[model samples]
Target: MIVSTNDGQFDQLIDDLSRLPTYTIGRATTNSIVVANGKISGQHARLIQCTPTCFIFEDLSSKNGSFVNEVRIARKVVDKQDTLRLADTTFDIDTLLALLKAEPVKAEKPVPPVSITPKLLSEVESNSLNFTEEFADLKQVYEQYPKLRKDCRNREKMIRTGSVILSSIVSISAVVSTGGAALPLLHVLSGAGLSVLIPTLCSTLLSTEEKLEVIDKEYRERYRCPNPACRDPFGTREWELLAQQKTCRRCQAIWVQ
Candidate 1:
């Protein structure tokens, strides 16, 4: 789709311009939208089989606006032989024809399709099954790591603490100035310092929580049962099983160990 607008009027005219191509520009062709001199040059110009289709142009709200048949059109499509006026300048219909005729004609070519055989289809199906099994195994590993959820929560808490501190300082300063207090400048400085300190404490606490979460995630991902029968990594309590339990979550088979 092609859209055009004046220097500062694109936003206001975009909706109208969007609806034009759907109605005028037919399917089965490649289209070009041209914007020139702060107005639609050709809004719905299509290349059908490499041949030019009907050219459509419209005006966007402009200081030096568009006029059709000597009538000012803030937004309207123009066809061949349509007189276009911009500001005090006038354009004859033949001028557009000459411009369209100047464009070089383009040749169209046909596209070929490919044929698929049963062997190729079978291989594709086999690869798909292998990918599904690998994905299932990864999902099982991810589900075992509870630290992912904990780390996310801690990061959120840190962001909220920082925002709250900034907001509180701004709010306190506004309230104090509004009261018209005769308090000394030192008092205001102390209040500001206190606000900074509160958020800093909260942020530090959240950061420590996150650091521990990272360590836990790392350890859980690295540790796995060496036993060949139950070599799965433990994650949350839901996935963790007691020692001597004989089920493999990924394969859902009995564990030898």
Candidate 2:
């Protein structure tokens, strides 16, 4: 069964309720019909399968309570025509059920059984060993940090040297060498100042330190997780917690750093 509502809150509310025999409508993450509101209880109301195709909704001693078609119901068998309300959102139960009935059911394709040979087993073992080696590379990723800093320093020095040399040449040509001819002193000084300003702007803006920092950040993100089996991205709440602990959410493997 598929259900869709115009409300942003119930965007992913559509699912096969038949497969989920008992659907709990609440703010809790564990609930099937998750309301995701502060007002609703953790395990608010329960929806039970009465028959093969029939469902019944029952209020589970909720603080806010549940209603059907504006009337507060303690327990009521769901009908296609019924309008259910929980918390702030007013669900059009009749329209949702109609859409569910109209929606076609897709049959799942059967997966073929794996027949592991000696060559395949050898490949699998090789992959497992390579995976561990890849994670070992994460530890050595920071070893390149010293080299990166040195390179950035060298590049900055080169830029500074180049800028100084260019500006010096321009200044000597325009100011020191008078060409033994009648030329305006203001024009010559202005030309030297303009030449120095261009090089100074280029050196300041195209900084090697900024470029090196960007590259370092990219690598840090790439090699965050030490365990290759649990190489989940390191930004989420679960991964953040894992940083303090020795457990990973992806592989459910306990590790020591």
Model 1: colliding residue pairs: 144-235
TM-scores for the candidates: 0.20, 0.29
Native-structure RMSD, model 1: 25.8
lDDT (tens digit, per residue) of candidate 2 on 1-257: 11112222111111111122356677777766666679888988876532222236678988887888888888765544567777655675443233221247699899999999999999986554233334434333344334344544554443443344334434323222223211122133222312211221222223454434433444444445545555665532333344366545566544434
The most accurate candidate by TM-score is 2
Candidate 1: lDDT of 47? 16
Candidate 1 lDDT at 131 equals 27
Q: What do the candidate models score in CA lDDT, each in turn?
A: 0.36, 0.46
lDDT of 1 by residue, 1-257 (tens): 22122233223222121121222111112323222433333332221110011223345345555677888665443334467665555555345434332367688786686566999888876543232232233333444234333433454453444344334334323322212211221133222322212221232323454334433534353344433444467544332342345444564543333
